[model samples]
Target: MSSLEQANEVYNKYGAYELMKRGISEGLRHLSAPYENLQTEDQWVGAKYYGNFAGFHNNFGGNLAETKCRTASGNPPQIETTQESEELEAAMELRHNGYTKIGNIYDEDVIDEVVSRYNNIIENKEHTKSSHSNDPGDGNVYIRGIDSPQEEYFPEAEQLVTEKVKNILRNYYRSHIQIRNLRAYRTHHIPPELMESKEVYNNHWHCDGKTSDHIKLFVCLGETTEEDGPLHIMPKKYTREYAKRNASFDRETDGAPNNVVEEHGEPVKFTGVAGDVMLANTQTCLHRAGVPDEGRSRDLVQLYIAPSSEPLPENWIDSELEGADPNVWSRLLKY
Candidate 1:
């Protein structure tokens, strides 16, 4: 069989986790070459989180989740000796410290179309096979789940990322701003039964990644308030401090240290109407999920973009994303 055929068998029989592992082991020489040539010569400064890109190694609970699947007691937590000598590179467009917020970014006319498209795929459960469940301590935390294909994103919603987003990208990325992932999600649903459920350990303080690399644009699709689980993110000062210290807390299971919050002050929680936008670097600044009120829910669309425009592997095509638009996701995923 051809090498590509081998990759397909691994992907089809195993999963993305195994495919990624195979890539790192067998294709690291080819993979590292492209990533090494990234050049950034522009006004916007570039920052590296985790010192170097750790890729799958950077993942939280990647092993613990599987360990729990095999045995009851999860693996013991390890002390992370990274994150010393923090640097805060300023982006001209980032607001409220590390993100930019735009209120009422869309009108009903545009929102109705976007929401309708998102719901059709999610409600019908047409996951791209890349979706997985999150353990919300008590049960499946159903609010955030798998991703719908980008083909589901309508043209009207595409217009939302034009001028304002272009400027933000220019200020944030030194090289060309290439979008990495785009998906719409239904956040926590507050069913009557879940109302009495215990708070998830994940609903506390955490950062998305170790470094200041990826940028995420989060859009709210419905009415949101503090009662409905508002997003809380640390402002600049605390973020800067955390940058220089060793990673003290478990990002996947632990909340932000009480001392950090105490010294940096409380996180800024957002409350807004539909069509609100919050841009954040989840890699550097600590953030936590909002808890929607009982019986209430939230719709969110997120765009993850990065600077590198590396080439994907040849056999990368055998993986899922069968229904994804080649024009969109093809440009996004660079193995």
Candidate 2:
């Protein structure tokens, strides 16, 4: 029998509890390793396995009725108009599907201004500080140390924290949320030879190790099409199945296999015009960035957020909330 068939047989025979225990065992083993000694991929494995185990327990292991009660606010936000109703429905879809896109949230002027700023930065690369990049000179340039500038260039980013957004987040998290990090980057088309040598600019499907409560708001700074390296994401249900099939979490790479993904459901690709915003629970979904077509690039502004005791503020993009830390599990987990 095939490996997938074997996984299915094991799951059917012993049930989900058995799979959970196996996953937890592997997770504990990784967690027990010394942090300093682990390589980048190993560290990712440690955090992803253990963090996902924690997320599963938090969301599913407890009392079913109690979980429902806690998640369901007895008094939901009142919806009077069509827009309000649609926003609420989108919020529900986000919770259920692990992602949802808000179309054309920003006007053309806003997109133009943001894109112009990005172009200036790109042209004047010598003066700019980059956070990281896929290659030294060519692929996926991520602008660094521009937190304040991002706020000025793309004030529409603040729209991510508006009343409607806050309501959606609050309803989903069942708690107030705060901006964890903000980033702006441009994805340039890498050479085909380089693409063959390396992973397709995060094209390998993997889950971000952040906790389940975390959601990333991806703002397209310009018109984004399938050729522009759009994001591809699997729903939460398929992610769980993928996890079960690889309960040991001992894959060769951090990404899921294409065959396994194909065996499950189709991935949803995020492709839309400028100003579209995609809200994704990256921790719960399996996702990867598509490779942009040659001679084309994609510009984006990303916001990372998580549940917090403090309520979201209007000018959250400029707030003093903690920045994006590479060691995500360190902040969220005791170990």
TM-score of structure candidate 1: 0.59
Q: By TM-score, how accurate is candidate 2?
A: 0.68
List lDDT for all candidates, in order. 0.50, 0.60
lDDT of model 2, residue 72: 42
lDDT of 1 by residue, 1-335 (tens): 99899899988888888687656655544554453333221001121233111122322222232222223212222222223311112244363366767556565777777667667766776652322344445545446534444634333346446445544554444334445466666666544454344334246565553224457777776677877777777765465555435333433333533334446457777667767877777655667767676676666777665544332223332324332111211222332
Of the candidates shown, which would achieve the greatest TM-score relative to the real structure?
A: 2
Question: How many backbone collisions does model 1 have?
Answer: 5
> Each candidate's TM vs. the true structure?
0.59, 0.68
Q: What is candidate 2's CA lDDT for residue 6?
A: 59
Best by lDDT: 2
